[model samples]
Target: MKVRHYILLVLVLFTGTLFAADIRFTASVSKTEVGTGEPFEITFSVNANIERFGAPAFNGFQVVSGPNQSSSMTSINGNTSMSMSLSYDLVGVKEGEYTIGPATIVAGGKTYHSNAVKIKVVKGRAVQQNTQSPSAGGNAPAVSSAPSADLSKSLFIKAVASKTNVYQGEQITVSYKLYTSVNLVDNALDKLPDFNGFWSQEIKNNSQRVDWTIENYKGVSYHVATLKQIILFPERSGNLVLDPLSMTFLVRRAVASNDIFDQMFGGGSYQDEKYKASSAPVTIHVKPLPENGKPADFQGAVGTFAIQTAVDKSSLKANEALNYTVKVTGAGNLKLLNAPKMNFPEGMEKYDPKVTDNILESEKGVTGSREYKFLLIPRKEGNYTIAPMKFSYFNPATQRYMSLSSEPYTIKVAKGDPGTNVTAFSGANEQEANLLKKDIAGIKTGAPDLYKDEEAFYGSVGYWLLILIGPLAFIGARLFRKQQAENNKDQVKLKWKNANKIAAKHLAIAGKQLQAGDKKAFYEAVYKGLYGYLSDKLNISAADLNQQNIAEQLQLRQVDAVLISRLTDTLNLCEMARYAPVTGISEQEVFDKARSIINDIETHA
Candidate 1:
């Protein structure tokens, strides 16, 4: 009886060990490759129950649906088996190879890991046969019994250009349109073409909602909407290719749900299917301007343009400045066209031109006028004729060279004092004037007594002190002036050096406002403080500052991506708070965050 019991106990121990060793945790994906807009499922499965679960960081993808959990237990004969799975639906935001890291789960006071998975996101949706079912995996819900609709036939994007062949610097408009025959829940742009050899500007769409209209394409009626309009000007002469534009649309289609609970609770019997569409690449032939009639002084101005000139006053006294305005009006490349060269008479000093552009960018291309104001100052008394200034450009429409000239003006100047010139007498005159006011004694001709000279030179401490301090003072002054000169020359470096102090001053004022319970004033102060700090630190203009530009500038400085992302987030938060009403956020919290961001930037930058 004892021997039989020992044998039975040993067999029972062996069986327990075998069952324990069968515990396994693994991860899998519905598909290894997916479209940028399409959603895919990731499942973490184990044969045992977990106490805690930790997910991996999905860096390049956005989470669409969440931690759906399912478990099952089965008994076959005398053996029992159990399984649990956690699944997530995710959508790729960009096209690249991404790695989903291992997920951790705790079971029986021990941690278990799921294997990592790699996924490839292509530019467009995967091609599917008409007979194949659209439902990918068991985790996906089925909404109908019918097969999935044809995505390529139901949805598409078309890129159309106004002109394919154009001269360099001529304007071309490209329109991106979307046509669909199915119901679309939402759509988002995945990729915007980088016009490498062209200057491109987006024409803003005022209406936020997409206005769909019925249109016919290839004898098929479909709903169409204009997605975007871009105005591009080729910068070089060559066969330039415009890259393809890509977008993703979330489509709702009929599918049969196998789960009775899902079918009962869910209002509709449809599943969301993501479809991607890309426009065809376009080729443009940019031709160089004809050199036969190209003017030597051509300002690279293309398209039809006209020049108008006026002077604030045709006649002015000597040393007085006169405003001479040159306005160029019409369409095409107004921002890029160089200012017309002006030739003023001798004795008339001309400062740099102050250029102002009133160009309105639209589908018709850049239109409006750019005015160049030349401030001319007469230095001496004279009667001089200001010769006519000429501007030359090639008009692609006319297929010929065009020139516009400003009318000549005669100026009369009266005499002015010579001393009015700021550069006339600088350091030399000041030094001579100081020296002339002092009286000078006659030079000593006879030699002094040797003992007296020794007592004054060697025995006196004051003489040695003067000798030691004189050169040191001169050297210090010289170094100080040199440093001042350098600081004046490098304005960017100077601003960067003082950026922290300036930011601190602004923050201090913000703190005061926060203490006084002025919400609006506090937010405004914080916004200005942060903006000023970025402007000074990055040496960028306040008017031209933006999130995209800021990130680019930080990248150029070799700042880490995480730090740059934090800076961007902080700026965006401050901007939103400035315009919107303050709700749950505290002013002190914002102030602290701004301060922290500045400190981090200073440490890293």
Candidate 2:
């Protein structure tokens, strides 16, 4: 019996060791060396079922095709084997040596890692002589008899700049274009260029479809279309480099075949091929503006501009308000231009000017006008003069600083009527003045005539009644005070009182998350803000809050239908944005919407 038990134990141990030995994980690549624009493949293989997989970040490379997965199981004799792999196709952007990081996988309650791979990228074309296999998980042609087409000759991207050299804060237009000779079925931008040391504004097209035109380049006629256009303003003086723009295209190619079997099976001699193209990096030389002859009022304006000033009324009462308007019109960085300062006469009070920008941006640059309106109130009656307003800007065309001045204005002020009292105080002082005036006017008038009764005694009914009512009023006041103290201790009432303050704190957190580009955390914060606000305001538990329940509760509070609908929609969006793919909705837009809903609820609910 003891020998049989030992044999069973030995078999169990042997089987466990064999299973452990069968588990294998590794990473492999199709090639270790390639040209700058040539494509390559990397694959990760595992022998056991995987519960999760984390892909490595492929820095300095653009992914052309994604994580294509395949699995298979084979059995021979009395043994069985299973294998799975994840593959990716990538293209290099620049010539350099790069390392592909290791990938991690979790299987059978154990973690596994693949080895890192090193690759060398050089200049020149790395010709792929053999056709790619059909199971390589790509959209390219499976088989072809003729050699592959030269990508540089068939398709390419060009970067054109309106000005290669510019002064700091000057506007320059850069456009990316696509030129192709082959038939293209689909195209998409894989990566956008980094515009370092510059502020960029995209010029949006009204229509989605691009207008293609025929163009001649290098003695060849190719169809060309503008892919993107942007207006860039250099933030500093230096040789700023615009990184290359990467894109992928699906080209339709005609396959050549001579086999009779190919024709008999109707294997159409046409296939869709995948290719990638990139624009050359562009260098911009930015020169600083000349300090000589620069105006003292120059506030970083780098364009031609004209300033005009006008007073609404030349003559007005001393205590009346007048509008002093300064309008600036012309082109070049209008949004960044500061408001020109004005010199007003002494004893004249002026408030901060309200600025309005009616600006439009295009490929040519920023255009339109900005208006500044100042409210002036004269304290004493006199003739006042507002000095000429000066605006200085650097003109790139003329390569010199220019200044624009507006005509001076003279205003006549007369003392206001004493009967119509005009106090210089603001807010509560004005209210207090009216109250005091009314009280004085009432005292100046004689008191009303009095009628006395014939009988006057301490035991009269009216006197006794007044004495009894006073004690009863005091008792009622004490009870009301006690009730108010108890209500102050209630947790629900406390939360309701501070609901807005709490919501504001959460919204502030959400703003930080948005600025950091943390989509998941941002949405979560917004959700918490809305939920916590509504629960506290309505005295509802957080667990019981939902779209339907919130709507019902808001309706009970007599909230407006439009406001309720907005709240519901905003909450739904917050929930969906947590898991949905990133959309065109901007972080600012979400923040503004959430803020508006909360304000509306506070006002109407």
State the lDDT of candidate 1 residue by residue for 474-548, as single tens digits.
999999999899778989998999999999998998898789886656766777788788889998875446566
Root-mean-square deviation of each candidate, in angstroms?
28.9, 28.1
Error of 2 at 335 (Å): 0.9
In model 2, which runs have C-alpha deviations exceeding 4 angstroms? 1-149, 259-268, 419-605
lDDT of each residue in 71-102, candidate 2, tens digit only: 43332221234567888877666789999999
As for candidate 1, its clashing pairs are 142-256, 142-257, 143-255, 143-256, 144-255, 144-256
Candidate 1: Cα lDDT at 115 = 94
- How much is 580 displaced in model 2, in angstroms? 26
The total of clashing pairs for model 2 equals 0
TM-score of 1: 0.48
